[model samples]
Target: MSKPAADHYESLASIPAGSSAHRDLSATELPSDGDIPRPVDLGDVHCFVQRHHLAHHTVVFEKAAIIVLGETPLSSVPGITATELRALQQETENKWKQPKTLYFTILVCSIGAVEQGWAQTAMNGANLGIPKAFGIDSNSKHDAFLLGLINSGIFLSVCLLGAWLSGPINHRLGRRGAVFVGSLICLVSNTGSSLSLNWPQLLAFRFILGAGLGINASTVSVYAAEVTPPLIRGGIAVSWQLWTAFGIFLGFVANTAVYNYGDEAWRLQLAGPVLPTIPLLLTVYFCPESPQWFVKNGQRYNLAFQSLCRVRNSELQAAKEIYSTYLLRRAQSKLDSREVSWSKKIAELFTIPRNRRAITASYVVMLSQQLCGINIIAYYSSTIFADSGFSAFGALLASCVFGFVNFLGAFPAVLTMDTFGRRSLLLLTLPMMAVTMLGAGFSFNIPADRPAHFGFVAALIYLFCALYSPGMGPVPFTYSAEVFPLSHREIGMSFAVATASFWATVLSLTFPRILTVLQPQGAFALYAALNIVALVLVFLFVPETRLKTLDELDHVFSIPTRTFIKYQLTEYLSWFTRRYILWQKNADLHPLTVGEEYQALVETDYEEEDMP
Candidate 1:
């Protein structure tokens, strides 16, 4: 057989020995092509190393059709203009910045901080926990409605405050300072709730708590996604859901402890869950500022880039790569930020078909999770069990079981989310949820007066918790963050989560009334029926987002404004399968193993279109 021609990326594993190795380069400047071949030029840099040389890498270069020569090493050609080269460099640099952990932590801490307010926001149920422990008859329709109203009011206030505060705080204090301030507010509000002597005093504390949490909810996602490495961004972004779930679990466990303590135990219960902050505060103090925030605010770019590089490992030229990456991102952000208005924002969302579909799908996923009856169990099921003749202690014990199940549900997402992606998990879980919810409804269909059926009711409760936790509970938020691009990440996540909060408020406020009007069987039957509807929505609307990049998302959703509502079901299904199955498997081919192929693609005048 003839010897194969030498490939462009043949030496990808090691930088080719060159006279220019000692060239004095600015911290942000990459070497010119004259010093190295195109393949070696790209290979010697951090972006190429992580993107092409690293395992499981998938990067596609757009041709010189969109070059930004002012910012890139120019290759003089007969036809190519300087303007075209500038555009390409700008695009490449923008795509090169990877999502890092420092980027993800802002969301994690903000969510953790806001979660402190959750104790008070849901204190209406907490109050019930105490009364039930004292054998107070609180399952009466009127009492339940009052509790529901309190729950609704607290969540509504918190969400509204969060919506209003997110943009301003992010614009003013930046991510780090804003989070530190929000954490302090949370510490104060939680501490106040623990000391409240009356219901009104407690409710007041809850509202303030909502303000702190609301600010965090509004700002965290954009803050996190901005700094995350693109390769692991999806996984790191979803960890916010994981940590928030963990926080909620802590809330339930603390409440259970108080319930078990009986008289005066509420004090300890209210105070205990706030303790997670001791470490959270430490992170706010020491954590680095978000790199995107620094670039957006025109801060010291080199400093921010260096801080980010440390997180990815400094052995590689990670700092210089980050600097180039930030340059591109900053330029695009400058372009996107021009004259943004409310109408424009809303129009942009729907005008872009892919984003519109993603938005609709996000709404369904949120409803699926909220209506799965997880919150109903966490916040009020103790009262429900008592109505069925379980003792106060018995009902409290059941709620603890519910928490444990939700905690268990959260793990599978952390474990398999990267491998299976969000769409697959959401699609697979919906039908199973419908069945479980229906079963739970039927279990409750048993006459409440019949104490003999309590065991069946209890079993259904456990099954309900089991089905809800591992899948539905933590996945919606993960999907929401994954679907939106970096440019609209903050606003997109804020609005998506706002939708969840809006419905959660409505449900929390009215679930008691619904339960009273429809009775247990009717109420659960409604939620179960919604689960079926949720399944239909996911099948029709959601797209597979598994390994797609932020840049890809921007392009995917940018399909013309006129086609916004047209659901390209066939194309999406094909896209989903290709990405989830075939592409993922074939992607296992390592860069090192396939170096010969890359080498052939990187030529002096190599166009991106010529590669793959």
Candidate 2:
């Protein structure tokens, strides 16, 4: 293709020229410790002033080394020499040209299947089973409380134990193996729930089920974050929300399908998550482990590179492109020899500032999720319908509808998360939630003579589920996971989510009392108030994690000026388009070089002495 016009070139350039711009060079630049930095050397350079003020500057360096021409008030150039310029040019090129892949879709499916299935929606099905076993005709407030406790009990344990296992599991088994193990446990525990005969038996099974669910929930987030290309890290991180929507939808379908089967239907509904686990296991089995995790564990550099290329379906050279980035990052982060024991790592989350902020943010987000009245609706939808003048069967149908709306809403999270961003969506959705909750609660407060009015309450509740599916239901987990550090990711997230489960228990057990003592209006008003609080917390604390890479995020956090959302969005878009454009722009840049030219170049780059 022909070169673009001068205006097009100006628009495409990232660095600005003239006194309007400041030279934002690194305060202290580091040299490359490993691998050849990928800039075309522009050779030697000399500067001379030809005439009056209209002098021109020429830079002879690497062909592809990025150049910026900025105007200064000084009549002559600075004392900086050609050698300094070459070193700076090579470093910048290496910094800019790292390769990336889009394997998050693979991760999205794997983690989505397990996380959405067992942790979130599968429990929604169990809400029906609780009342069925307890012999509650109307599902009184007491029963609602018990059901929440049953679900939340395991969550409490998850908070306690999840951190303990996260580090070891990720360190020893690797990302893929640890995640698969978690999924397997979930598969078995969900199946066990289907066979339980009584409330006590079901409760026991749920505790075991929660343990597996906890592991799956925490580990998948860590694995997904570790494996993603930095450019689309935020978008990939949000996939957890998308899959959760899927699980909620599936729960509804399964619950409705067995509605005609009566009490035994709860058993089938409990087992619904098992269907997705098989594929989740199979896909994760085939996918490569996280390259970063492998490098952290002391694997060879080329092996990690090849693994990335295998999943990316790109050329072998792409391995160097990716590997070179890790080397630079590892050096800069001072991660070369930084190894702490698992126990110490766990403690560090609380003691360290970065980890503290992230973990606290996670806890707040998760606690906010619990306070949203999700469990009250999840477990008591049928009971609420019955109280609102529907038959027991009609209540079950209404519950099914809630699930349908929840499921359908998840797809949009996948689409919108990367577009509108996490913080923007969180800020926008909370007010809508307030309106929906008020509508549902106020419907119950209206006079009894209003015919079909209770149905409006039910419809408003359904709208709440729709609103939740896209924002509250899915976004928090992804956000929590994103904020956590790699050192303690699994445990930190587990602790946060476990808190959600704990509150769910509190809400479940108390909702019956709350509804009865203060009436339905008081109960929903409490949740609406909590939603308002969550909105404020999100505005102040939650960052937009839509586009950032894991490495870039580390750097962003290292500094203190900009919030996470600002840097996250900027860093992502910068490289997201550049990597692909590199290949498109240079069709002639390939691995199939003619004979000795390629062999000698490869041999000179990698000798037997440097094999390790």
What tens digits encode model 1's per-residue C-alpha lDDT throughout 180-251? 666667778778877877656666776776666766666555566555555555555655655665566666
Q: What C-alpha lDDT do the candidate models reach, one value each?
A: 0.57, 0.59
Candidate with top lDDT is 2
Instruction: Give the number of the best model, judged by TM-score.
Output: 1
User: TM-score of predicted model 2?
Assistant: 0.69
Off by over 4 Å in 2: 1-115, 118-129, 135-145, 162-164, 329-336, 447-451, 485-491, 543-612
Number of clashes found in candidate 2: 15
Q: What TM-score quantifies how close candidate 1 is to the native fold?
A: 0.71
TM-score of every prediction relative to native? 0.71, 0.69
Question: lDDT per residue, candidate 2, 306-378, as tens digits?
Answer: 5665544233223323434443443334322455675676687766545665665676677777777776787
| Total colliding residue pairs, candidate 1 | 27
